[model samples]
Target chain A: MSNRYEARFSAVGGQGVLLAGDILGLAAQKFEGRYSLQSPTYTAQVRGGPTKIDVIIDDEPVMYPKTTAINFFLSLAQGSYDAFLYDLRDDAIVVIDPVLVTKWDEKYKTYQVPVIEITKTKVGKMIMSSVLSLGIMIELTQVVSKEAIEKALLQKAPKGTEELNLKALRTGYEEAQKLLAQET
Target chain B: MSSASSEKSDIVFWQGNEVVARAAIAAGCRFYGGYPITPSSEIAAVMAELLPEVGGTFIQMEDEIAAMGTVIGASLVGKKSLTATSGPGFSLKLEHLGYACIAEVPCVIVNVMRGGPSTGLPTAPAQADVMQAKWGTHGDHPTIALAPAFHREIYLDTIKAFNISEKYRVPVIILIDEVLGHMSEGMIIPDPSEYEIIDRVKPSVPPEEYNPYDTQYGDVPPMANYFEGYRFHVTGLNHGANGFPTTVPDICHNDEVRMIQKVMKDVDTLTEYDEYMLEDAEVAVFAFGSTARGAKMAVEKARQEGLKVGLFRAITLWPFPEKVIHELGQRVKAFVVPEMNLGQMILEVERSVHKEMPIVGVNKVGGVPVPPYEILEKIKEVLQHA
Candidate 1:
């Protein structure tokens, strides 16, 4: 457990949580040269129900792929935040969308970033919120290098949307930097 | 054979289903006929996108049965063919599965198993199909099934599945749990020189003299493709040396015996297993597919506490590897079989070892994987009882 870092990205289906988790896992393996496994759980319905993807990254080969101890977590909806906050280390970092997840737990280190709002105003696409949240999650946890995440994001981004997706990512990253600066 | 697709880098992150398609193409599989089904749908999707690029054919049939029948038809034409499905789809394909069996058609079927007696849990993982793969088809038929634990093994085994099917002229089933199907992980593409690729043995006799089921060529007859200028009868009925159906007691009996013997006689070569720290162990955990992941971690944790525990993973689920289990039972105090299904393969463990040692199963259903802690607890409990 100590050798591996586990994270869960959760939201309602079609929120791009799966894609965000996929890109993060890809970055961990392809760019950062670490071992990673990503798996998702969702309802049979195509959309609307809560969905979550669990990612485990380790230096050594990951023998057990599922999450035992979550090191970092991000929830983009209230229902997700309430349902999926489990098996976390005492000091696990939690990132949430302040607008979507109104309720909060003060026990763990939490960052209230308006990821959806950032995507709507700056990125101009609601679907890009997951990408923005990924930027904030990476910055808050520093699980993977910024360069690695950016590279993976560009590779996975749809054709003709690379520049827009990068903007959303940088905006969220800058927001995270500001939050860290305030703490300092 | 190599997964040399430009879309796949030397080392890349890929879903388990995606690698199956990649490996199939690399193994020279030229025809894919499958219906879209959850978990296993990615295999068809990848095959559809890549097969055309390789001059292969991808057909989406009306139903799972037709999907299977299409693969059989394609394979009969000498194209290495494949089909993939999960749960209910797998059940529907059984009709053709048996047809492929007695007809001696060489093709691969990938069943990314979801929870089910009848679509029990479509989005969940379960290993309940252990017996189904072996005995689902009516009448007695030889079965060769492979269960792979990791993404890398999925690639290697998918290739091996086709090779085994071709070598023995039998349908090979690859049983993958839904978790393994949906999970994405990193693996390096294997080099072409690293592995051997096997093709079916074609007949050298003239077209007029060729016999598809000629026993003179030994247990496995030299097969000639349908349109390869050698036209011979192929049917699910009991076949004689001349490839025609026979009702004679001796001919029918010999056909049935040879069908099963073709696999049983070569069990040693067909068996692929993984043993971890079994030497000088008091207990052994028998597991496969995704369940093996948990069992492996439990063994490691048990080892750290100085427990004499080990893991025996059955990569080849059918052709059950009973002899190996029988030998291990003699030395070990007990065997713990953990799977997503409730005690399906545990029965096989009981049969293999007889009553020589105690055998217990840690089973679960309805989506969640059996955690390592649960397996560890069982190991401890079995040790105390043993």
Candidate 2:
């Protein structure tokens, strides 16, 4: 693991992407015993506008809270992908939701997953898509442990839907592991 | 049981605004009066829910003026009061802020600044309020304002603001920008007993003998509560030692001079700053608020490139640290100031150094923070010119 890791989660408003970043930061700080900083940006509109959160995890203190260069970029929509494409480093990993993000560049290594479909089918809610994408990112990058993420999810997830969200997270993580194994 | 004692004492993650609300509670703040505004509404919301549970009072006033007025009233009755607002709301509270200064009420006013002249960007960051925090009240009264760069510093600074307000009988301003207000980071909420908490000094004389603005012992006069049988007047007028309105030339002149001397004379104890990599440095970046975070990173990167760069961050914004800047000016080659506003604080740096060294400003005003690379470029430019 590197000393510093920067990740950007981009999605439209009301997708719970900001909450996903909050939980990831909490997991890294509270459970993983690391330092994390999360800065979120969104428009004045409550929904249907582009939103993004920059999360920096490090062993040392995070001096600059904003992400300078992206190490991992997760795009849940084509608009967000296009808006944040210029922020990626030369060798950054890009993750896209296949249903929402249709266009991508061929030069960068990209991973496509049907995160929204999985959340809708397994968790019976569209808002859980961010939690599903969070699981996939954790499995692929291993930035934080699964146990830590699950602990934060239990603390932050909505009441009475803990079981369904847990199931969605497990399904997303298992599928990502299978994809990486096949690639290897 | 207090949350500090009941909850886990280890490190926890919290947003900057939430930390401010929690720190107020920890510092024995019993009354919160505020109006909702963008980028700062979370502080009011958290206080609304937390205050009642802790046996304190929370009020949402009709407007920002009334909000500040309510807190000032509560403070006169011997309660530690606080109010949080953003740019426009801060503007509306300036009238009452001047009242608090002249009446010698101890309270805390938090401004989580967004872009402004008038609501320029409700959700973006700007440090344009640097001048307003000092001169916004429209008077020659003393002001002590603090600016914190990160989440952990926000918690400690909030407590310090309350303490300074109580100790000196002045309204202290905690001026934070939108980026620090909305960001989340890991911070350790210390045990309640670990920090020093100061309360207002009460009157030692009898009710009939007590004078509210008496300055015989020192510049700061001991306070008396409203309903504590100490019948005294509180107003924005130029009053004498008896707390009533006065027009005598010597009485009014002395009153004004005492207010200024109370804060200006104790500049050494009132000012606080963070100095980074200043040992044998040639160039120093002077920044404050959220911009200081980027300045620290720029200094670190410059050090790696064999550049003698350091950072001078002003945690205490007002009663500007002139002595420190004057001493460093004789040693350092140049000063680079980066801020979210367009050269608001660089003016102070220039005034302090007396043009003895080259001072450069890298400013941004469109609601975005000045990035670290921009400051690095300015540092290189200043080095070449020097």
Candidate 3:
């Protein structure tokens, strides 16, 4: 019931998780210090290992960003969700791509965004999955304007592929709307 | 009134580890020797980057022992040196740290503590290293240690650690935790000129007239650097003013006793802590480093919920903050110590405070933090019982 929310992102190390956290941090800082915390847990395994980034953005000063419940949990890979689903808030929303997450409860608020499908269609690369997920997250959060986020992304992301990522995000946004419509 | 180099910047956001390294850089520390460990690796990494940029050197020693040994050696060459590590690494450095103490070598050690006893928790911060920082070495010796709660103090307090080490010619410990080490926030980085950096007093007299261990002239003799063509033996064994081995019970006892007094005499100026809400509260929770950060949040939340809860954080871990602990122990009905390990600092609190009163320990091991809610719960438990 609390308007305060956190987005817990899980993936393997090669999935650009630390980059994702930095991007989220940039977005928050650009949005006037929304009391956001971007804490990432990296294990000893150097590459292709489990990575969890806890991004908690609250309405007030954040003391520590750890909690047993997460309002938004996204698992880019099925293994990520399995490792973290036990701690998800009961009513929390989950968005996983059918291609990435082979099995997911379709009856729940889980929406198979087909993130990989959108990424491949829009950007011709599955690496844009995180970009597309960002689009879905912006559309859902409504905490900041999507345009502001896009601008922030443009300002922050590296040379080249910025526009493509934006388009990929829009694709994820539209696909998420269609999937949610079907679920309702 | 000045040397050659200078820089100016009023304020900037900085990481605790970054500031610790920056402080060392500002303190004329041209040498940084350390092994990499969680929550503390950033300091080593930063020093690796910053040191060479300014004509200094950084080495990733094989272990903490070598790290401490090299820093001491580097200090004798008239270079300010430092090392940073956590619990396991801190333990490893203790033997040589005692070496630095007995030899009266001035160097700074930054301990970014995590949960411990072993490789307890790498990421989570804990304040359980308080007692360890004080008594980690084997024998009776004066130790100068400071704990900084915020990123800003990590920089300023590091300067303090360097000053104490240089002034007293002993190892100074800058005790922080994993939380502070990694936590980044906005801070004011003072201009280099605004702070006074102290260097060890070097011998003005000729090399032939020097006495390395002389206790006559205010206990610290002038140390001429190797570059200046003055070389003297530095030993771990008790030596005369001439720096030679001495086993006479009187000479050894006097040397060791005088070394401890050099820092203990000024312990008043070294002890730094912040106490909040304790004057009126019957329950005060004692914590430090990351746990103190948690305790602050918990105390504020409890106050909003109409509970009179106080917080006491030890900024100076060594020589113990007994004054604050003793004073609060009498006024407060109970003392709650929340930390990462199982009652490392609580034992010290118990020893300092009146044992007749309630002294509860909030401990969590296995590399996790003692959560704010758990501390709040202990506060409630104490209040109800009181």
Cα lDDT tens digits, model 2, B1-386, are: 11121222276778889999999999999999999999999899999999999899999999999999999999999999999999999999999999999999999999999888897889999899989999998978899999988787898889999999998899999999888889999888866776789998888999999999988768999999999999898888999899999999999888888888899999999999999999888999999989998899899889988999999999999989999998888889999999888788889999998866789899898888888899999999999988
Ranking by TM-score: 2, 1, 3
Using Cα atoms, each model's DockQ against the true complex is 0.47, 0.47, 0.17
Top-lDDT candidate index: 1
Cα misplacement distance, residue B312 of candidate 1 (Å):
0.7
TM-score of each: 0.96, 0.96, 0.87
Candidate 2: C-alpha lDDT: 0.88
User: Model 1: how far is A25 from its true place, Å?
Assistant: 0.9
- Candidate with better DockQ, 1 vs 3: 1
Q: Ten-residue segment with the worst summed lDDT in candidate 1 chain B?
A: B1-10
> In order, what fnat does every candidate score?
0.45, 0.48, 0.05
Give the C-alpha lDDT of model 3.
0.76
Per-residue C-alpha lDDT of model 2 across residues A99-184, encoded as one tens digit per residue: 89998987778999888887777778787888888888989999888988898888788899888778867877987898899899
Worst ten in a row by lDDT for model 2 chain B: B1-10
Tens-place lDDT digits, model 3, residues B1-386: 12112111233434578889988888788999999888799899989999998999899988889998999889888889999999999999999999899888889998888876688777777776777888889998888788887766677788878888888898999888766676554445766776788888877778888888776678666666766766788888778778889888998898888988887787778788888887788788888776787787788778878898889988887778776788778888888888777888788788888569889988877666677888899889988988
What does candidate 1's lDDT look like per residue over B257-304, in tens digits?
Answer: 999999999998899999999998999999999999989989989998
Better of 2 and 3 by lDDT: 2
